[model samples]
Target: MKKILPLSATALAALIALSGCSTDTNGSSMPGMDHGSSAMSTAPPTNVGTETGADHNAADAMFAQSMLPHHSQAVEMSDIMLAKPGMDAKIVSLAKDIKAAQGPEITTMTNFLNSWGESTTMTGNHSMAGMLAGTDLDKLKASQGTEAAKMFLTQMTAHHEGALEMAKIEVSGGKNAEAVTLAKSIVSSQEAEIKAMTELLATL
Candidate 1:
């Protein structure tokens, strides 16, 4: 003789069966019953488009031109430290990150300058804030081991601070939406790195 299962047991079995199959918004196979949030998943970037015309300004041009060389110098300083003996790992990592981020910004800024009919090369005194000088660079270069690492951290922290200042200026005075966006990004990313570097300096 065959026996029927209890109602609760039947319901549980039905739930399991339903969960085993699912469909997407387009009626495609959902597979594996992904009840979890797809919102958490990263999607490929879509064509959000770019800003044009009056959004750009002279301030944006200047910001890009000056920042290109400034960032280049920072990357240079970091490279120098990376090659030195007995360098701190934290500082070395910071240097590598700085090089990675700023080089791309330099290219973007140069492109902006070219598009805007402005000079890609740097101009004016870049001594805005936290910018290093001849003596400071020399000190960083000549130091050894932990001292060199410490100097690099200190100097780079200052450099990033300068970048933050410039970025703030761009946010306030820049006309181009894209330029301001990049400026804000600079402020956000560099400021975090500056804090990291500062904490690293304290440890050293």
Candidate 2:
């Protein structure tokens, strides 16, 4: 060797810094390294301000499951009235309105059940209130003119009353905020519809 030269301070510092930043087997820099972009890019997404599956209770689940079939029956009844000829204008309009309102409600309840990981179908053979029997539906299908309109109004009034009963239970016992809110809304709107149906029945 010609001459042994000591490394300068600047070059020594640079060497030490590079050695401190050695990467691990996974290619991520060692601890204490500035991992500005790479670290942030690999981070998992945050779920803040979102509704998760754990947000509902048993009452909420039951409300959704029960309302699905109830709303479906309302829609089916509306369809039956809509198909009948020579129906009163007011009755036809009411049937259309019932169809419009309850169809979306059915979809909303179904989604609530799905998100809560609950079955959409209600278990047990418990009969829902105000549901027309097969014979009642047959009589409705056979009637015409004012008779059909009267039957629809009478049947739908009872149906709305039954929905009000179920919704009141939800309003009192449901834990999910959205579900309770929907229950309250159903109470209000269906109450009004029931009143209107009562008035219509008087005329028919």
Candidate 3:
């Protein structure tokens, strides 16, 4: 005759422990069992802060797209003047200002485009204000001494004016507060630069 004994408390506890130690089909530790480390230990923790998305409209998109190349051409014009010999100290200083200010602005506008999931390139046949024709750039590049400085001032004044026109559109129509702020800055700064260039051109 065989005698069957009911499972003891110690034996039941052992069974429970074994079941808790069992793993899933994917080899991950079963729930309620501590693996002695965080489950996310395999990868470093990420910290994406509480940042909300930007709210932009079509006008904001247009402002970024148009302004990028406008600023780039301004930088290019500044470079042309900087590369020349015998530039006036004031003119040189202005060129440096344009380069310093617009360089960061280009990056800012690019970020606006990226955040909006928009293309950085302008769509359709858009004409930018204050843009130098290829021949105008060639003319400016070929000049020397005071002539180069005068040409740069003349060209940049017009370029800045063009920027003002575009910026006005952004100020009036843009939805993003940041873009409008930048537009206001461009209007104020470039207006002052335009006046300074006009005075400098007279001296040249």
Candidate that would win on TM-score: 2
Q: Please list all clashing residue pairs in model 1, or write none if there are none.
A: 55-175, 55-176
Please write out the lDDT profile of model 3 over residues 28-109, one tens digit for every residue.
4533444533243322322221122347788999999999999999999999888887778888899999999999999999
- List where candidate 1 sits over 4 angstroms from the true fold: 1-55, 122-126
Candidate 2 per-residue lDDT, tens place, 58-146, comes to 88998888888888988989999999988899999999998999888888888888777789998888677778888988998998998
How far in Å is the alpha carbon of 81 misplaced in model 3? 0.8
Judge candidate 2 against the unseen true structure and give its global Cα lDDT, from 0 to 1: 0.82
Clashing pairs in 2: none
* Colliding pairs, model 3: none
Report how far off residue 61 is in candidate 3 (Å).
Answer: 0.5
lDDT of each: 0.76, 0.82, 0.83
State the lDDT at 33 in candidate 3: 46
